[model samples]
Target: MSDHTPSPDQAPGAPHPRETVQLIGQDAAQQAFLTAYNSDRLHHGWLLTGPRGVGKATLAWRIAQFLLATPPSDDTGLFGAPPPPGTLDIDLDHPITHRIHAGAEPGLAAITRSVNDQGRLRNEIVVDDIRKLGRFFGLSSADGGRRVVIVDSADEMNVSAANALLKMLEEPPARTTLLLISHQPSRLLPTIRSRCRTLRLAPLDPDDMQAALAQTNTEVFGQTDHLAALAAGSVGNAVRLINLGGLELYAELIAILGTLPRLDRQRALKLAETAAQRGAAEKFDLLLSLIDIALSRLALTGATGAAPMPEAALNEAETLTRLSGSPRQARHWAEVAALITARTRHGQAVNLDPASLVLDTVFKIQEIAGHSR
Candidate 1:
């Protein structure tokens, strides 16, 4: 693949996972893979499963680098099989690292959603995408070295693609490993799931999220605790929040929510206009998601009788507490959130005016607030 070729596997506004040297806050997953490697129980088909932005792909790539660079345990050198390597931390200067970085690593293949005949990227991994790995297996097999293929993510594989992959898992080629990254493993064929050993990645907590964000070139501004809470432990989400001015937008949302039944009309309009602006499609999407988050938090606050801590935005606790004051109010907010979500989808489907849809959604929430009172 050309270095410039767009990859669906890459998170928006974040560096390619392969480019990330460190996998933050996933020590357990790392240790799991390492344990397998050392015990000589490394599965031919490894499933890297986790939520988005939780370093699954990074772990896969790290394993790929380790396998390709490290000699087989049986192949004792002059030093007689170094006592089973402890960590997957390969040196940056390793030749395999250089080749992998250059996208010229023959032993590794990173599969993502492929481009169609029309030059547009397809939404699902087709059979052809999975079959293409046959060539990778054949060509790399000649070297008699470990070959690794990463499908990020296997959940996006269509039925045909999934079945094709299942054949490989059932009868894998010698000295080859297939790493499948999946956000939702349940979507995979049961047979496919059965054949692989799963390495589950976890969401990064605030401190780890901070360290992970540092590895990226994304400039840090505003409170990271807020980012951490809003992102739900996903580094990918945090990076998106930062790049899209989501933190500030969320703060403004919290401030608006503080007004409750009588919302700050001018501020509301400004927000809607912001989302409706030409070339603001991504931001508009982010706004809808933030609204969903806000409603959810509100419902949880009322149900639990306490606001979620380290608030996603300043005064968010106050707003959520004020609006969702009782169990009845919480139930009402949940019902409202459902209705607004339905309207949001319908509005998108029909390509409704962004500003009108946003204003209408806000109005509905305001109605809920009034009813709750």
Candidate 2:
């Protein structure tokens, strides 16, 4: 097995999506594809739509492995052989699986954002990246097998890239399959979406999430419940939260928020200073994200007349209720969330002082809460 370790910036101990063989919480999608394949009505293109990190890529790989490994069913008209495959699994030692693990499969092509001259991943998948598919399709399949193309996320494609892909979907080649993964399907071109068969994956329930985490060998033994709540059923999000110490930071945030209307200047200043330290950019960004989540929860609680289930800390539920019990207050916090989100993005773009930006956001929240009373 080739190395499938994630990068330093990625979730620690988590394998790449392609390396994940057993998909959890996606039986419906698996069964759908099986039905299509067995009935010989499988479409050329598949759109996997769901929230981030719910095993879209894993399912794509599974399909690709099955397609490449399994031969096309013969039309012997009842007396040929056994029934069609009910599952996507291929033998672990299959040559196709090994080739895919090493990314050496001639019949497979993956389109994702490429690295620029600076050695950093590009912000979007450009047209040039999509153009490479022409060469990929130009070559005949090595063993006269099916050709597979995977776009890890269709949402990251720019207009030109998306248009380039649309052309392929318009006239796909024989025995070729294209799998497009998307976190937000609405952001894609309507024409592209309409052309593909969609398979939507829902967030995993707690039991399924725990099973998924265990399959990945994630060691969140005593904290599965907390991680489940914070991650909102995304295994990727759960891993990231654990790696970034997000739970602890969020607890500190709720602690500060509990003193709302009067806002703890000393504690707030300390948190801001910590985020402003050199080489703490990720921490700073995480802090900003946590703040937005807290505000969103506050707004949601007030809007729904239901207390938020405590995720970060035990006092979070009471804190949310105390600060935003009325719909009017909820509206105010929602507006504040919007403003702070915009402000924080703009500040980061303009290279504003991180410490100052954090302070400003807290102060704005405090101001809103004070008047909300």
Candidate 3:
């Protein structure tokens, strides 16, 4: 299915998309939304929170599908949830289902970032968009029951846009449901967070990640165990890593780890420069994963090998592990890891240039490696 297209059962102006989202280990959360639909007790606003790429938007679309399936109330756009799975299977062949899939529902609406004339992300959901939302939801529900407006993510809203959204949260219209999808709830205004019933989505487990990766049918360079360790519970990141030449990068990283002891300053500088020239976020993530994998290898070697890792990677990994009695070199390597993480987070918040950040990390890592010698 096209990423932006509505599901076959969703229509425009409707609150829910017609798509069927596969809920993974989030039964309680799904049931809460389902219960709200069943009882017509749906809140005016809902906050969907979780780490990035763990299916927040997918869940929102599921709720949207449910809303579009039922007619609206006089002032509220609410719907009774369909019966239990055994009782009734929603027929996909219905005309209404197709309409919803086309995003033609009058009871549903969604606001998300769109590219502007300059071809860059608008960066914020604007007041104009919020104002339009107010106008749309204020109208009587065409189907005569409930109206829903889903902000695919409230986290992207700038200060003004957020304030405008806050106004609606302050005095939401009757019979209207608001679904705000957010990866980072802390970034949103506390007032906004306090006003809504929040449903948190948990990270996917390693098994789930493996299943997802298998479905993608891409080659994973490292072992599944190693990739899972580096993935840190993000299926989206794993998928990206697999598709974007990650296997090659992992192989190169392994080669580097094996050779770091004999690696020269000039060669390290070249590698650092190469890393820095790549986008900072991408390079840092790759480096982080590489470091983690190397550490694991070092630990394994120390457990079985007669000699520790020749004071090259072993010392760095020991310090990075933060164990007591960690050597000075290990601590230095750990410090470099910390710096990369901190800068990456900061760059995301302030929109710093990624290339520059990558370069900075490379130079620092080179210096650390030199010191280890």
Q: Per-prediction TM-score, please?
A: 0.94, 0.93, 0.70
What is candidate 2's local distance difference test score? 0.85
What lDDT would candidate 1 get against the real structure?
0.89
TM-score of 2: 0.93
Q: How displaced is residue 272 in candidate 3, in Å?
A: 5.7
Off by over 4 Å in 2: 1-13, 75-81
lDDT of 2 by residue, 48-120 (tens): 9998878888898899989988878863556776678889988889999999989898899988887767566
* Total backbone collisions, model 2: 0
Q: Residue 9 of model 3: what lDDT? A: 24
Is candidate 1 or 2 superior in lDDT?
1
What C-alpha lDDT values do all the predictions have?
0.89, 0.85, 0.60
lDDT of 1 by residue, 1-373 (tens): 4555567988887888889989889999999989988888989999999888889989999999999999999899897878878889899999999999999999999888988877778989999998988899888888799899999999999999999999999999999999999999999999999999999888888889889988987778769779889999998898889888899999988888888788899999998998899888888888998999999999999999999998998888888998998988889888888888888989988999888888888888888888888
Q: Model 3, range 118-199, lDDT digits (tens) per residue?
A: 5555767777878888567656545456677888679988888899988888898767778898888999999999889998
The order by descending TM-score is 1, 2, 3
Per lDDT, the best of the predicted structures is 1
lDDT score, candidate 3, position 29:
75
* lDDT for 360 (candidate 2): 88
